[model samples]
Target chain A: MTQYAFYFNGKRCTGCKTCELACKDRYDLTPEISYRKVFEYGGGDWTKDADGFYVPDVFTYYVSVACNHCDDPACTKVCPTGAMHKDADGGLVLVDADRCIGCGYCHMACPYNAPKVDREKGHTVKCDGCAERVAAGQKPICVEACPLRALDFGTKEEMEQAHGDSQVADIAPLPQKEYTHPNLYVDPCKHAQMANEATGKVANILEVM
Target chain B: MDGMLTAFDEITLVLFTTLAPAGALAYVLVALPLIVSGDRLLEEARRRLDRFLCVPVVVAMIGLVASATHLGNPANALYVITGFGRSPLSNEVVCGSVFLSAAGIFWLTSFSEGPGRIGVRGVVVAIISVLGLVFVGVISLAYDASTILTWNTPYTPLTTWLNALSGGPLLAILTMRLARFYTAGHKLGRALVALAALALVASVIVYGLWGSLLPELRNSLASAAELAPLFMPSIGLFALLGIAALVLGFKAATWHGEAPLWLPITSTVLMLVAIFLMRFQFYMIHMTVGVGV
Candidate 1:
């Protein structure tokens, strides 16, 4: 029962969205659905000094996110049909398409906005951690496609061992880590804000949604 | 802006929540006379009321069908029972099914043997009434997910029950008129009107308090204020329609003779529309604790 995890180096990501496009291409997703999303979060206003000189205080950063496969997923908790469940073998959250009624409860409960109800598919769809690739001893398509090597994937113990335990998961534009205890680890960049900070906003809302 | 899209995407659900609870309560209210004092009513009046029970039952069925259409795959709906007692939605579905089944059985039985014995019929109606109230409560709990800040409050269930109370009596009055039960100037009719009036005023106060709480509910993706910009105006319209409906209900209850058929009918429609408006706003203000826009 080894839990898999995703590691993101925020400092290396340039918000190019290559990972997003790569996952879309791999999954052949429609325009409305994306397994991965890159959010551009930015905020801060200018302040005037005593000398009447205006000073800028704006900051911005990119947060590439997909399903974190949290230990306490809100989506799985609210699903009426038990269609969404966390796999016991890989500790990966997966949807059983045969049982899904596509009520959108998963979509509404997920804090990361990962799962979506595809009306054409007649069920909710989301990232399943690229289980096939992992089975073949290869990384996810998005991780392999990241030119800057910002994204990594491995067992949760390995990720925490390699990138110290302290930076496991916490960043702005995401909820408090205590809420879901996401498996995704992060190496925050200079402009990164804590999860509790309310000053910043998701700047590229149109692109993300 | 995203909230509006989310709301529009769930338009069928909005309609379901608006109609189902009120319809369930209406059925209970219409049956209250039979359950409480069936022996006192003339046999002809009892038969007429029993026959007209189909009206509220049909309204509830329409709501259930509307909810089924919201499912992406209706074929898998039966699997929902697997999550019963575990998921709030599953509990809601199960409760609604039980209530509808009881109501359907009672309605079917009324057609045979001239409304059956008074004692037996009264007991069955009492059971259905209890199921109906439980169904409404389950519906309210369906949206009480902790992840949804806008809906995870006492006000959610409070307002839901109040909405059912405010709209249910009018629908029952309409059903009574259709059956020619002649409730005008009766104690029961006056009590219903008074109950509706009280619920309407309480609904207004609760909604106002809920609206005030919305400003503080925010996340990185959106705020409740941004999600529901027209909250005040929507409530204003609700109040106007509610007052109008109350006025019509009062007039019909206190009328000197048999009230005009159009009076209760119009009042019921107005109240249902008002409830629908609030349900629409409920969807519009959907804000998650994080990026779940």
Candidate 2:
């Protein structure tokens, strides 16, 4: 199976949230739901020097994230009806709406806040990595719509080759890579913090939620 | 708490967890007299207790119905059993169904048979009683997911089972009193009171330890403490209600004549509310290891 992955360049992303809007527009999602989100992580405070001068040590960065289609997804593990499963062919996690009871177990278990139970639709909805578009050899709308070309989607091998081998999935505002082993790879910016760091918080919580 | 509204969205589930386990255990406790005495129980007392079995049965049924409403599409509920062994939620549902079915069947059979079927009734009650306990344990395990830091702890199941123990005896006392079955100064009455008191004390300690641990549990979005700012206050309220119920229960157990009809009933209601408060806090402090809320 060829595993699909998302590649993000934190240095290029301006936190414009264009990718977020593009995915929402493609899916025609309600305001309460977003398949993709751009998290603004910012923290640090000013310190006074011995010369009585105030110095700033603040930092901020953006992380554009989607499902990541993890290898061992918590959502699929907790879904009672087996409605949530990872596809064997492309290794993309998808939900089978016909079997879903809309119990929200997937929503509760997902660390990335990816899958959401749409009460009106009576099923859990999430990003499928634009499977149809990928089948047609086209990039996802979110990746194509990014103005700075910060987002990329391809097979794991392709993403590794195009980006660098050192690119990782661990960054602030996301859990440790060991948790779910997400398929997202990031070329972090200078201000990027490790996943375990406690210095930053999700600054754009209102916009994301 | 920021997630207080999020927890309220699951009001149906909160009711389910609050009512079902305690109600199931109450059914088991109420059956103890029949199961233990068998042929020794008076025929009229046997008939009265048998008729009163419907009380706990109805309580558990109401909880099951409320839980079904939590599903966005109840028509697809039949598919839940297909996940029986693999899913924790499925395991909980299957266990609850088994216990309820056993209790319902026993209640129906009681109407057809006479006191001579004491052996059969005793055996059936024993089996359902064990199933009831199993259902409580399974429901607690259902919420112990590794990704949920606040719920994954052993304290989660500890508090849940303790809540069931604390409320079950009070409900049993209420059922016995309504049936006009005298238990004042009886060994069974004293045992029930003692069990409820011990369970209440344990629940308070477990909840206290759980609250202390919440401050350290955090993710990028929020901390568990922020998600459940009313944790300590809720526990305090629960303790107050529990003490009131125990006081009333102790009075009923030690009464010389038939206990006042309202004593056990009022105690049961207070304990149920106390259990509900803890269950509400359980949902309020829902914090994941990462960003999920």
Candidate 3:
């Protein structure tokens, strides 16, 4: 069971969104559709100390999220037609475009919001972890497109061996990691926990699309 | 919160959901009592049931059309039942097909002209009537998926059942009245109105309880927190309309002389509108875990 996973070094990401662009271009997606979504999770405020000096607490970081290709994918579980499914070889999640009825149930079931119904194609579409490229021993387009060298993808063991020390990917604005066992590893920034602490809000929602 | 709904929660899906359950319950509730009404009211009840059995079948057909419209490729819809053992959506399709088929068969057989065959028709109708109830149960359970936190509650199925029980009799009595089966001072008509009223009141209570407890569910999004204000007013309107319809219907059914057709017609129309509004609200509040809020 060679499970594929994504590793994101939140400390290095500049939120430039090259990964998002690469995915859209590769898929030739419509404006409303994108296989990859880069969420900018950030929020904080300046505060006055007892000395009456203004202290800046504001922070921001990028979470370039696409399909996790999770260990227990909810999308596949709820898909009536078995269209949103896992790749047999590498265990990456993928959509069988021909079989999709475009009911959007997979879209609804996915906690990662991975699958999107392409109305023009009349089928649900999502990232397939670049299964063909991966099979050929090449990185996914999103990984290769990152300028910050922040994103990585490989077998779960390789990702864990390289960056497993960041135990909990439980960043707010994103859900609890336990929900889906998302094959996503995050080297969360120092202020990343503020998404849960200060407001429990996703800050750069407007910037993400 | 902005991504609470995709293109899925559109008008066609809403109408499909509303009409399917309503139509199934109409057949089950209306026909069940008639099949068991004994010799006293049996002849009159059979006559009324026969005349009206086609109504739910037609409604079910409209629901089938509405459901097809929700599909991106309806040409592939016949294959939907292929995943029946694992998928609730597939199971819903299977149940809907069985219900429509059984109802259609029963409708055709019920039209036989001979009085001697009425006994056989009653037996066939009773079996199909019970199967109709099973369809309602399946319809209720279909939406109880774990992914959509707002819809995954036990209360989700409960609400469907309550809607069917309450709305079914209203539709039934209206159908009877439309066919001139509402004889002056019929106890069964008044009883149906009373039953509908009680079920409607219970539905309101269940709805209230479901709303209050929703925030407590695990993994649920806070998106629904703001939606309460949006939903409460419409639900209140539904309750008011439902109560008014039942009251007016009761008054009309128990009236000593020939009851005015306008009263039951108005009441039934109001109730249908209320149910439609409630279902619209249902679709509007579809928030799943993690992503939506």
Individual DockQ of the candidates? 0.83, 0.77, 0.49
Q: Give lDDT: candidate 2, residue B61.
A: 79
TM-score on 0 to 1 scale for chain A of candidate 3: 0.92
**How are the candidates ranked when ordered by lDDT, highest leading?**
1, 2, 3
- lDDT, model 3, position A75: 82
Q: Put down candidate 2 lDDT per residue, B1-293, tens digits, no spaces.
A: 37787689788888888888889888989988888886788888888898798788788778888988889877787888888988899998889988889889888877875455778888888888899999999988999888887889999888878988998888888888777777534767778889999999999999999999988888888888898899999999999999999899877766777788788888888998999888888888987777776
Candidate 1 DockQ category?
A: high
* RMSD after Cα superposition, model 1: 1.4
Pairs in steric clash, model 3: none
TM-score, one value per model: 0.97, 0.96, 0.90
lDDT on C-alpha atoms for all candidate structures: 0.88, 0.87, 0.73
Give the alpha carbon lDDT tens digit for every residue of A34-92 in model 2.
99999989988999999999999999899999999999898888888888999989999
lDDT of 3 by residue, B1-293 (tens): 43225323567766776677777777765676556653445575567667688887677668877877777766666666777878887887787888789888777765667654655666777887777787778778877766677788777788787777667777776666665565445777877788878878887887777666645532323456354445667779989999988987887677676678888777776776677776766665666566542
Instruction: Tell me the spans in candidate 3 whose CA falls farther than 4 Å from its real position.
Output: A45-57, A194-198, A206-209, B1-8, B38-45, B116-119, B182-184, B212-222, B255-262
* Candidate 2 accuracy as TM-score: 0.96
